[model samples]
Target: MLVRKARLPDADSIHALIRSLSFDGTLLPRTFAEICENVRDFTVVENDRGEFAGCGALHLYGPHLAEIRSIAVTPRARKQGAGSAIVQALLAEADTHSVSCVCLFTRLPDFFRQLGFAQVDRTALPDKIYKDCANCPRIHACDEIAMARGVLPDIAVLGPAQVEERLIPLQL
Candidate 1:
């Protein structure tokens, strides 16, 4: 499979992959406009003949962290290294930006564990919680496990205090 940075023309294929996966609650649904706007964050994989195999994205939270979002591969593409290639490419992209660590919330932690990710407490990723979890429909009922690769940064911006301020208090 050939893994490469996504361009504008790749948006539809990427959107379809994410949308198909989102139905299972394995991924969050993304709007077409949002995909177009963040297309730069994505990397797509295709077969030698250029058939779309899979796609993944690295969402920059800051210099300290980037989140791996929306990684999905077609069933037909399984076992072909498309998913792994997409992730490896995204990790390389993180390294290029000097990001100290990459984090992701996934049900497939074992898959990521083999890729150097370790399970971590949600509290350890406050910036991620502040950005996505704070508004997520599953916030109070999330099932996905959090994982991170690389050492935690020395910077303190995304820690508890910073996140608490941004959280909207909820009442049942």
Candidate 2:
């Protein structure tokens, strides 16, 4: 498999792969427009024949943090290392930006763990909480595990107080 930065033409394929996994909440749903708008954030993997195999995105929250999101592989690409390639590529992208940390919320903790991510308290990622978790439908009953790699950012660019307030009830 070959991994490279996604181009505008890859939006539909990326959207389709994400949509296929979003039904069961494996990923948050992303509109085609959203994918197109953030196409630069995405990295795609292709089989030897150049067919789209999988895609992932590196969402920068300033240099302090970056997120790995919307990663999914086509059914035909499963177990073929497409997913791992996409993730590695995203991590490489984060490195390019000199991000202090990389984070993700995932059901597949073990998969990410093998890539050097360790479980982290959701509250430790205030930027992510304020940006996505506050609006996430599964906030109170979130099944995804929060994980991170590299030094955790000590400063919260978003509202940490508000994030704490919102997450308090979940801990109850």
| Top candidate when judged by lDDT against the true structure | 2
Model 1, span 54-172: residue lDDT tens = 89999998899899999999888988788898999999999999999899999999999999999999788878877778768789999999999987654535555656766758666
The TM-score between candidate 2 and the true structure equals: 0.91
Clashing pairs in 1: none
Q: What tens digits encode model 2's per-residue C-alpha lDDT throughout 49-119?
A: 99999899999998999999998888888997888878888888898889989999999999999999999
- Distance (Å) between predicted and true CA of 165, model 1? 11
Off by over 4 Å in 1: 154-172
Candidate lDDT scores, in order, read 0.88, 0.91
List the candidates' TM-scores in order.
0.89, 0.91
**TM-score, cand. 1:** 0.89
